[model samples]
Target: MSAYKNLVPRFLRYVKVNTRSDEFSDTIPSSPREVAFLKDLAKELTQIGLSEVNYNPENGYVTALLPSNTTAVVPTIGFIAHVDTADFNAEGVNPQIHENYDGTSVIKLDPAGKYVLDPAEFPNLKNYQGHTLITTDGTTLLGADDKAGVAEIITAMEYLINHPDILHGDIKVGFGPDEEIGTGADHFDVQAFNADFAYTVDGGPLGQLEFETFNAAGAHVVIAGKNVHTSAAKGVMINAIQLGIDFQNALPQDQTPETTSGREGFYHLMRFEGTVEQTTLDYIIRDFKRDGLETRKAIMQQVADDLNHQYQNRIQLTLKDQYYNMVDIIKEHMSVVEIAEAAMQALNITPDETPVRGGTDGSKLSFMGLPTPNLFAGGENMHGRYEYVSTDTMEKATDVILKISELNVQQH
Candidate 1:
């Protein structure tokens, strides 16, 4: 058997569980399906010999503790991953396995159409030739976004449990829900977790270590217009679709995901659907700083005002704050970042410290008093049908987890 056989099998099992989080749901886990999945995981944790395994259905936080074998004043560390998959279709995920890939396009079957993982579109595919790659069926995601992280953390813990000679301190495992729906940390119990510092194995793309994320918010615009017959209404008719277009036109043409990179922020229009009676526009504002994030939101307000002014305040705007950057909180304790970097270095992996363009649960948990930083989970093109991960990269990520545990003991 391969060295990381357990990791792959564990990931496969997790994908089979239907834990798709719902954005419209009102529960903590968002969907009732997550409750069943967490119970299974808790049972597995007990089977793996972790003490005090917990699965709280009300809050949807799964936790477990691994006691230190040799207590030498080791600082407690934590690793966390969300158990839920994205709202995107996750049914019948028949992952195609490519062993010893040869740097070529791999085809996947989908009901919509046949898709290919071409190296031309995905540049990172070139780095994994001659290694295994597990891809989706072109219809659904592989659930490797954070499930890979979950499997990796559990597999590493299992390794340490089997090897008792490896002296370590207290370690905590945190599993979240509704991550893809943006409420992963809504009920995270930082004080109860009790870790000096934690790392969320929820970062995307291998070798990624991010302490910064966009200050994000969601905006909803409701356009109300007078209903009138097209043939008889000349001056009384106000087309709601035009008002929605006017709202979008006020924003900068260049500031978008397609044009922005690095630290540049963007006001993204997610979706807009409506007709003359009424229209709805969905927008998200993102930036690295709170001021800028607010500014982008203010720009949206201006757009709404411009349209409302034209339509006698017919547009109703709703803006809701989501999450913020974890960088400021992490700076207070740089040791965690250094330890992660040292661990990566030990594995011959160079750490790529970059600001996350999107938010992770770690960012919210840090503000909640956990001081969590994100560690890469070896996945790419996440929450989409084209998602994939290099088998060698997954192994490297597991190695990094092991080294991090060892280094945490050594440094403390």
Candidate 2:
């Protein structure tokens, strides 16, 4: 079957499995539903004639191998995609298919007209004119973020198996869980994957080829205050909620996710909850440079330290490093990047080398010695309602995978 013909159904099937990951869970896969879906995917890989189909229960990764068909010892290539969806409502995802989308119409997502996908709000919708777009029902995310990548990888592998004339070296494919929570690749066995270089097909939009990502850290701040009755609030009441506001004001007001873009660093406050007695602030610090990330972390600590000094040590701050920029590792292996660029050129797709403002599995995998970069999977507005993927773009992504394999063999 053609790649486009196989892509839609395969993608639809994968997204409906409800593999949404949890950030708070302590399990290996974060959620049991992820394990169940991955187990089934493992069986499917074996049935598709892949070899060494092993599902590692310890890390919730399913890896399969397609043996080399040529005698020339070419470097092995690996394609990876995460099986888990973002922390969005992914239950009973009823995907809506818009065949031959008109460029300008406001497509209503629900029967009640409460949600709509308008070209005005998302100008990129015009690019998919006359193409098939897969979207959610406005109640949940479409989960196309990485599912499109998973489908494309599997479909491309099946194509290579069917076409024996396309000689290539051994190709490895891995699908892991809990990527949405940023811990899926923490336990990734790079030695077992055994690829000289790899690509995580988890980027947004078509033609996006990224290697640089934010150096990240998470910060937790707690403020403790003495609560008193309103009538006796003269000098005895130290409101923790007010202290929380003061702490936030100490950070760079202009440096935040909303005000920053491309190569800029920011302090993103992800969560805040508390009462008069105690307030906690959860923040994610991001920078493209390691030194910049450290500076951002230090700023948070300085803020807390200053507050604690004035309030008799009523504030506590904790910071933890999350991931680093993949470019630091991928730069040394520019040949791998050149290969992807050439593949896109051959397919007449313009290569967009935009630096990712956020990190991916590739960020951690590169540090793990995989030297992985990220490729596009045709998803747009990921991780929430109104997320969509173009079937035409997905077909192109599948073709890119095949082309990359062919080009690698030719180069070797």
Candidate 3:
């Protein structure tokens, strides 16, 4: 907020911690590294003069409170971000800094030029021509997905602690682990993180403000087959792997992650493991509406039903809902969205009210009685090696946090 005074340094420091989460791990934080980093962050919050700073090991969240300086009644707002990176290589993340980018030059991410960040492919690079850009060195991911959010939140809170004259009501800050694997907020203690409403500083690009996210569900399909000797396998054997492929073909091929955009829904085949005796297919279904998600789920069920009738009940399908669109809960509390939009406008930032294609912790938190909207953290091309964040945009994001805190009290 103070013109990148602490934002860039904090971000650079946090991204190097190697807090990548594991989807296969059954632990609460998913990774032991995340637990250690979260404990360190809890200590840092306490050292920064924040009140009630505590790390709950049960939920793996470090929560703190910036107590109000004013006696006037105002709603207690919260800000949340995650500490874990996505399912990518995050070891020894050496960030590259490009100052005053010329807007047209190609960015070689490695000495061998194996990975390059070019304006022709990523035209958003042109938008931050004169701003500082932080990117990965092509050896690993930059972890800016939420580290940028974590840094911005802490910097804005630090600024408020330094300048108490800018009075406001109580502000809550929460940082959690394992968000990348989609289970971080599953055990989140929303009651303990008490706030009237919250905002997730976990969006991409500049001016991104989102309250809508995909209505998500995960499906697991297993097919059983009779394995017979090839010498006598003439009508006695059923190949489960072939049946799995048939099931996949039955789904709409045109509707997929690469082929869809905006509000369009998709059935993503994430993992497929098979053998002649048995095969398993793991899929994630995403849609913006609940009915659309249900329709997709029904399609999977019908595929299983038809296949089971043919194979004598050799197929098993399990479907589970992951999260819902936060807009369904946020629309009733439009003030939360209006305050963020007003804050961005006050800082001369255009409010991009685009819907997120994926889910955030807010997607679950909003349903847990906290209506949260998402604000940008200035990162682009998240979850991969080409990921980058604009320091100028991060400073603006921090300023938006401060402005939102200030305006919440002024308007209330």
Candidate 4:
């Protein structure tokens, strides 16, 4: 594998820019800082000699192309990664690099030594022995969930551009914002990208090649109540907060995110805000099968309806389908999955084919006329302060991208 010396540096530089997205924001990128980063990334793409570099401020998408050097009549491939981080404190992100990890001692993250990344708590750190690891300062997430992927894609493109001897076909590169909030691919122009198939470099750990993702939906429950004086509130005042709790309690206790794993569907109550007069419950529903997701939604509605009937219609429910499992779409284009597996096998990286517990931008892209799959970005403990990524693993991911490109041409 070629040495990708700049991967860690590029990731550190990108994560420090404060690109945390807002889920409630009504903007394309969901955060203003993401636009600034997109501008800088567009310029960086142009500087790195990628052709047709363009940043669409309208949708907060940055795209470019590396035209094929050979006339192989191969399928045009794409590599995509989101630019925005999750809903964590991404401001003032100070990345710490631990070179040649010994894999036994605990890594102190904060200057006060109160926060640490211990191998006992996160056993995955032991896998990075003798590899350089990049982590946050225990105050914010490392943003390696996808930024590592962004840097790896850029590094791979640079490698291909530098080594002209390795012939390949036209490769499309995309960097989008708002993936953490599930709106990253909302405005992606699939026709404009024009790739037959694509891979999202946005999964956790190494060798994670995912084509199936959760069939997802969002549910909002609003409870309205009449507030009266406590002394004179007998039979007149209704506590909305209690009613919200009742609604939540009505759901199956065992079928929740905390209790389920490995293709078991769950109804996760993400946020709850309540007062005496009104209350709001935000829920996320996940299932690998479409019918399972429908069953979950139906049960939620039934619970709400039963409560409303008993309480004279004081509860309202709104369930919106977010994204569907990509397995249905990917099954039609099995070659996309086969190509990625073949590339990983060529590099001797054991392909870990697993279903994503959460939805990805690829889920939406697959439904939008592109057979896109998710590839691992080599990060563990994502969306938190303990997030860390192995530089060696990221270099291998870059090599996988290049190998996929090369193998695609050779097979064609």
Best by lDDT: 3
Q: What is the TM-score of each candidate against the true structure?
A: 0.97, 0.98, 0.98, 0.98
lDDT of each: 0.86, 0.93, 0.93, 0.92
Which of the predicted structures, 1 or 2, would earn the higher lDDT when compared with the native? 2
Question: Candidate 3 residues 61-161, lDDT tens each?
Answer: 99999999988899999999999999889999999999888888999999889999999999988898888799999988998899999999999999999
Residue-level lDDT tens digits of model 4 in 61-124: 9999999999879999999999898888898999998989998879999989888999999888
How far residue 354's Cα lies from its native spot in candidate 4, in Å, is 1.4
Mind giving the per-residue lDDT tens digits that candidate 2 earns over 227-278? 9999999889999999999999999999999999989999998888999999
Model 2 alpha-carbon drift over 4 Å, by segment: 1-4
Model 1 misplacement above 4 A: 106-113
- Ordered from best to worst TM-score, the candidate numbers read 4, 2, 3, 1
Quote model 4's TM-score.
0.98
Q: Who is ahead in lDDT, 1 or 3?
A: 3
TM-score of 1: 0.97
Error of 1 at 172 (Å): 0.5
The reply for model 4, stretches above 4 Å from the true place, is none
